[model samples]
Target chain A: MSVVSAEALRERPVEAVPEDAHDDGLAPRAKFLPSLGAVYRAQLSRARVARIPLLFVATFQSIGIMILMRGVVDQGGREAQAVVAGSAVLVVAFVALNLLAQYFGQLRAAGGLDHYATLPVPPASVVLGAAGAYASFTVPGTVVTAVVGCAMFDLPLTHLWVLAAVIPLAGAALSGLGAALGLLAPRPELATLLGQLGMSAALLLGVLPADRMPEFVQYARDLLPSTYGVEAFARTFGDHPDWATVLLDLGVCAGVGVASLAVATWAYRRAAVR
Target chain B: MCAVRGLSKTYPAARGRRGAPGTPAVRATDDVRLDIRRGEIFGLLGPNGAGKSTLVRQLTGLMRPDSGSVEILGHDIVRYPERAARILAYLGQESTALDELTVSLAAETTGRLRGLSLKDARAERDDVLEELGLTALAARPLKKLSGGQRRLACFAAALVGRRPLLVLDEPTTGMDPVARRAVWAAVDRRRAERGATVLLVTHNVIEAETVLDRVAVLDQGRVIACDSPAGLKERVAGEVRVELVWREKAPMELSEVARLRERAVESGRRWSLRLAPDEARSAVAAVTGGPAFDFLDDFTLATPSLEDVYLALGGSRSGVKGLVKA
Candidate 1:
């Protein structure tokens, strides 16, 4: 609370912008965005080295659930397709949702944001870069789960390429949710608990057959961001797939991904300055 | 060069069972102003909770001030923080490097984040690592290193950028004596070779006294004094201090020490006394010239130092926090 002279507080006139003392021009204003590729590469390297084992676990856990469901669901049925698609998407949720929440939560709790805040890069680069890195980690695991689940259920192999788009879009939405939860939680332990609960909800509401659930429960399923992604992938399994409805569902997933990541970016800025 | 004018911040108190329901918010920083000149090492000296970290955060644009502004390299940092980043390199009080990264990678990444090209960042990282004797640990992950090693890596990252301004908070906190000396040598080289302005915030007054060109002593969120080490020490020049060690076989009786009792502060086997400039010479002479001199094993005359100035100005031995009265 050092007192400023009253004159300094008044806005300077436009004409006076270049008139005062100490105006050496050696230092220029920095660009709002640094190289996004540099940030992406660094974040990706960190994720690969620190979280790959967990990614493996996510893949096997999803496949394990599918195998457990094989005994209950009849082969070559829509319910079997739902199980395969939902479990595949669940791997994305495990990393993008459960693990990312813990990462940012621990980062904030340990005062790590101060380092990034002092750098010249834009806050969005950090948000998007870390989100992208964590999402990329899910690609191999998501693909493995999807391909294995399809074979286990005797589903056709022609539509498995849908996973490429499905993984990132679904990953963005879930990772954004995870990042927000981590950044907002007061403690790291609380962030971990919230992340696990969020992943558990995705597993129960997103994977099960919609026909088996009551109408109200289905409404709740529609609210989960990953459900649209699951529905989009599940539609591709039919002998005659509805391409229009598939694109629409995928479009919803993409839209939600953008909106959720935006909120997570805002949350990052809010938490960092505190 | 950097200047902070009229900086102030207030943090809202948490509302819960432990909160005093109607108490006012905590004022972490009160109207504070400071100037760090070009190519000079300026020290911000204070006990804990004196707003040192808060002031540095404002200067580095890590936090927004509720009022006032910081101008760096002739640009107002509050309005153009990115420009500040272009000129200023900061090492925060907390260790902020990514734990999963190797030391060299962390340094290079930090340099890149500050706008260096990959090639230049790598070269700078190599030179700094060799200079700090951290080359041996270049490939080690941060979490695997000892506490001192991690601190050295953080210091290396801050030093390699070669910006015009450097802001370091407790940069030598966990370092050993040799490492501490090495870090100071690096800082000296930066100022001497590059003419960089350094804003060093630390509680290690003794070590900083040897390198600081000027220092501001903060207490209870306000600056109590600002001057060169010599100038600050001169404030108490009228008095002299003497260290005494008494002979175990010939301890003097209290009656014989009556003449020096009032002005003395004693602890254990040593006694310190303050005397007017004219009286000091005679006092030292009397203590050593008298018959009771046989009771003293050793005594040495000394001038007041920056440590004395800090203690005298802070008014307390502990780094306790409270509001300073206007």
Candidate 2:
């Protein structure tokens, strides 16, 4: 119960060394997936307190948007399907792209890259683990939005299960983008600004119908990673779903996810070395 | 064990035109060489901007040196910095990455990252928390703890899964005397029982003199002195410090007062003088035992300390007097 003094420890006889000593044949390097799992669990626990409340906010924001859009589209046409799907995927963009960018930007600006760099964990694990954790937060919000949107748009509920594929794919792509934006930006404020801009792009380009937009606008929509995710989900609302087109859109999302995550990992290394 | 050879790191000057000469580059570290033996507690002492942090960063492999190599247990850490995490446990000067995690989770997570098994990590977390007297605050978030308590939590995390070397930068900065004592006790125990080498960088010379087995003093990016505290203090052992506090305004016309004013430092009514032991003896006896005694409020003579050695080595700060000159 009492605090032990340095003099007290000095007076005691030296005890035998324990076996699991820090120097006993240097600690083996922690493998990738295991350490990634550890980082993921840590991020999950760390975000558990603040993020759950924001998750509700993100869900409500998407649900609120759908209610506003319901006034103009009287018929359950392609516009309604686009509006519903885009609103659903917007939830993914809010957390995975917007919040994650803010998290990483703050992390990097605060010299947090050095924190993880000092650890034996791989750079890829940090990037992938954090992206995965943020993406994981999108699941409930995305599912809720999609179910609510499908019912409101008078779309078939049978194919909503495709979200099992959509959330992870879109989540990965947007999470990677968010992580990169935050890590690459020189300042935390810039990172937050970039994240908001990306979410705005997701809202405008993704939530709106592509066929109604001008040629140049449609081109810009193709460049937006979340647009593919929205399109994939929207295709499922038709009388007969086009699995081929949906898979192509999903393939592009997965490709962008891979590329964005690689860039985030590269940015992590660049920031750490300084 | 850690070996640093020909280590030199110079930060480039930030401004210059293409053809014109640039601003002078700040030499953060210059031609430094060191061999830290296992089981010894080595201190790195210097004034502010004395390149202590730059040296520590290079040693920990967070920053690559401009030239030279750092080897820890035969691994060239400069080339393979990823291995550094396994070889060294670092308690940084300002760590906020784990502020969101609770004290216990911080320790447990650090243990896991350091490759401890889940059960072992928990067990070590418990042991370290108990040893640091942090068991009571283990559930508290780091941000919610006082500065000293949060620092203790970070230290506990560093100790969770040990590496061969401990690179602690001001580990006891905000700690109370008792907590500081505990920190040193834990470090000293680890070195004694497990032969861990410690590279402690601090401005607390008083504590360093007591806890350090050997110390290196850096000035302007150069290692001006490297020796045991007693060995370094031996350089000034022949000297004594004479401190006096006058009751009122200094009698400048008095020969003794004039003599004291010439070389001594003045702070209000107090004056401190450092001199050869024989000279100090004569000055103290004359000032305190003679007519000058009437003007004196207090006076004392003391032997030189490690702090005096630091001051004598051209470090960019004046000596810090032990008393408040009251």
Candidate 3:
């Protein structure tokens, strides 16, 4: 069939008019800020719910370990000293479980990144909101760990305020690290592998005594952020608090937390643009 | 309103042995220009690998063009992406809603992000869900819905924001015909009531034809044609098809019959002809005097369609060429 040009159609506008054309008299500018907040809350809620089961299991496990350590201390053995050592083990185990849960959640939630990027809001806000939701997930487990450690280890309950401040900071730092990893890992398999490797490294470096390992391994352990976290957490649960060491560890945790958040934001922006 | 001027994109070869040391880059969009007017359903038609999605991404501010400018509603997509985003909603080819979230939550969240109050967001959510015929499935998790239903849920999320511009990339890819029609109807309503401009990227020509005010056909990263569908169909002049059946068995060696048929077709008498205004009179005269054609039965005249124009413009060739001729 022969086709007409736009010039021809323009001359015969009445016959060539599109069937669906219409003129609506509404202004184009409409505020959409409410929907932006709604999208953020929806993403945050999904992250929170998905990690609940893992948080519950990890909390129960920490409580069980604290109870076992308390029983050993009550028996009046050298194992009483092992209680503080066991607390370090519990910290590593809890953080690892939290990281694993977050990594998988992020891998599953990758599709949402594209959706969020397409929105009018800054990509950084979405990343921060998702990280904030993840931090919320770790709160329940962190509180349980601190509470159980103090009750079972005869920790100085008089300084309870310190535990309150330290636990949340440490939890936020760990969650931030998990978010950064989730953003960087190229695929689900890589995320799983890195999560497992991180857990194993944290267990060996933070839980096991550094002096027992080879000189090179000891040096490597000192470089890990979890080593400082475990150290600070152990001091919080001990009878005598070393304020200087605790302050140093807290600084390290805060630094890592900021860095992790920065990395996550950068990754999110890059993903959005590409 | 969105405009892309001198927009271009190139993908580099993968690293290592597969990559040549100094190979030329693969250009995706080559200095293409477009203007999508406000409140119009501008269809972007192209086959696979024709860079339609890439252009959509650039227009939506998801991907930056290698070099060029994309302005949406007078806001430059790259320079003022945040501002542009407030007025635009993008429904990508892939479903972006979380599977764990219920359909209602998804809608509510999208509304909230667009800055609606909690109560107002919920009210809007209810209205959108009902309007999209998704109220029955609103309580279900996204994973539970069928593919078509899931797409509808995403569509509802995009519409919740009530943005002035909507950019959809293959929005009806997996939808059934009924679902596709429903989306088209919603789009129509949005344009009529809200004055929302739409940029739809799709390979579904027939579906696109139903809503597009004008279409731009892309091939190999260049727009080959841009006009109203009827306008495009008029470009292929002198082409016609004639069907004839005889009462007796077909005659053998009827040179006269073949000659007359050829002359009639050349003169615009066969099937649907595209004769120039001057040629039409003479062509009609020649066909009337032909002896092989005593009385033509069931003859119809029609103009070429967008599909025909698509084939004629080197649709099978390699390098990009546009029909808009400057």
Candidate 4:
């Protein structure tokens, strides 16, 4: 017996696939947007049962923080504005950053990347779809907290629509960071721990008033992407919001989102190969 | 429609905990070459650590080989790695991540990801579910099902929106006899109707011998034999494996036992001897005749199987060279 060479093996009259030899004619390569939508829907359905209760917990926790902070700050003052803004964005950080990290971490440790890699879908679609699904869970939580905080603090509701910008931008940045942490951690337990620590950082830094903080702590606050979301939402509570400053804060959030997501995509590709 | 030539991959050494030294690197696959024909059901067979799984990953472009090339459907998968998902539906042994999804959703979602239109994806998902006799279990989450049922669901997911090549590793593992037949029937129907080629990696030699058109037996990251089941069995032709079990006591000074024991492989109370057909008959008679029956629990004489070929080719050894091709 001998090893069969390519030409020698082709001596037989068999034909396997008869489609365009140069193309993936069996099924068209999945377009990015459509496939991303499909992944989002699937991930959303799969995660709904598990994340719904957590979403409630997240919303309730943010609301409780505002109630506690009201005792320490003057109503209708700048400190009150910081507390309300930080509490709202904290919802986004809780779901998008914390839960998303645990999800991808478990997926990686359990060899779930192999399943997605085998699919014809683009790798970016997988990361984005999951990020979108987890972030979507934060929408209602963030809104309910913001509305409740404004009422409790006697803040005007005229600029509540700014939440539209806050949730997605902050969610993207946090989701990307969460995803990267999960995929990079060698173990799922470590990923979960890291996610909890991240949510803690958002709580301690984002929800706290910056004026009383030590100078170094304020610098640390600036490093957290969710803090910028806090800043943007807090500025909107003024008598006349500075539109340019709000836009600048959002632009920074969006930039961090893209950079972090790119890092996550790179992490996913690296993990999938092994 | 799959071609692999001179593929090799070596893992880098792991750094030590103290950063002073490292564990040795592992060469998972050597310079391996194989060509699977169109519409063929090919099997990769080997003992544990023989690198069958690594080769399968490289062939599907999930893992990059250090050197060499892989082509599926005439496209260079080595250069355009993502093309593998288009050319083949890879069903790996690991399907735990899909455990959260219901059987129906898993199948339908896979079809959608394969670029099927929503309506077509649903229709095909339903068809595959029905064909696999899983319509009743379609709504059940995979984690709630039996291991065998989960494996069947994974198969259904892979089968939906068919690709030209199906790379299935251990597809029938954990399956009950009935489910295994259903899987093979579905695979056979696809091959006959749509001309799909199948590349299977399995440790189940009986299944391989029963269904595979060809097999490649690997040892130490290299293929030592590639041939049809019957062709490979010829490596141990004219030999019968006589297995004997003894009761509480051993046979004392039986001439046949003494002669066979010298060349026999023993595990616990059972002994397996490679013998000629006539020698096997004589040995069986000796073990069951007279007072020898008191010591003999049971015995069997069998023809050579694909497993014997694997053993003969040293599939469990450190390394084996020479390709026994068909």
Worst 10 residues of 2 chain B by lDDT: B317-326
- If ranked by TM-score, best first, what sequence of candidates would result? 4, 2, 1, 3
**Model 1, B72-122: lDDT tens per residue?**
877887776556666778888666436787788888878777766778779
The digit string of per-residue lDDT tens for model 3 on B125-188 reads 8988887788999988787789988988888888885677888877876778777766887787
Candidate 1, residue B52: lDDT: 88
Mind giving the per-residue lDDT tens digits that candidate 3 earns over A131-246? Answer: 55555455556555665665566554455465454554554565566666666677766666666666566655664445457999988877766666666656654556788998
In candidate 3, position B34 carries an lDDT of 90
* lDDT by residue (tens digit), candidate 2, A137-243: 78898889988887887878888898999999999999999999999999999999999999999998988777778999999998999999999998998898899
Computed on C-alphas against the true complex, the DockQ of each candidate is 0.23, 0.41, 0.20, 0.36
Tens-digit lDDT track of model 4 for B194-278: 6888999987777888899999988778988999999999979989888888886466586756776786767678887778889
Point out the higher-scoring one by TM-score: 1 or 4.
Answer: 4
Backbone clash pairs for candidate 2 read none
Tens digits of per-residue lDDT, candidate 1, A1-274, equal 1122335334422232222122463333223355455566777877776788898889988999999999999877899988999999999899999998998899888888888777776777777778788888888888888888888999998998888888888988898889889988999999999999989988998888889899999998999999988998998999999989988988988898898788888888888775
Candidate 4 Cα lDDT to native: 0.85
Candidate 3: docking tier = incorrect
Candidate 1 docking DockQ: 0.23
> Which is the leading candidate under lDDT?
4
TM-score of 4: 0.90
Reference-based TM-score of each model: 0.84, 0.89, 0.73, 0.90
lDDT of 3 at B83: 56
Off by over 4 Å in 3: A1-40, A48-111, A140-167, A185-191, A240-248, B16-24, B237-305, B317-326
Best by DockQ: 2
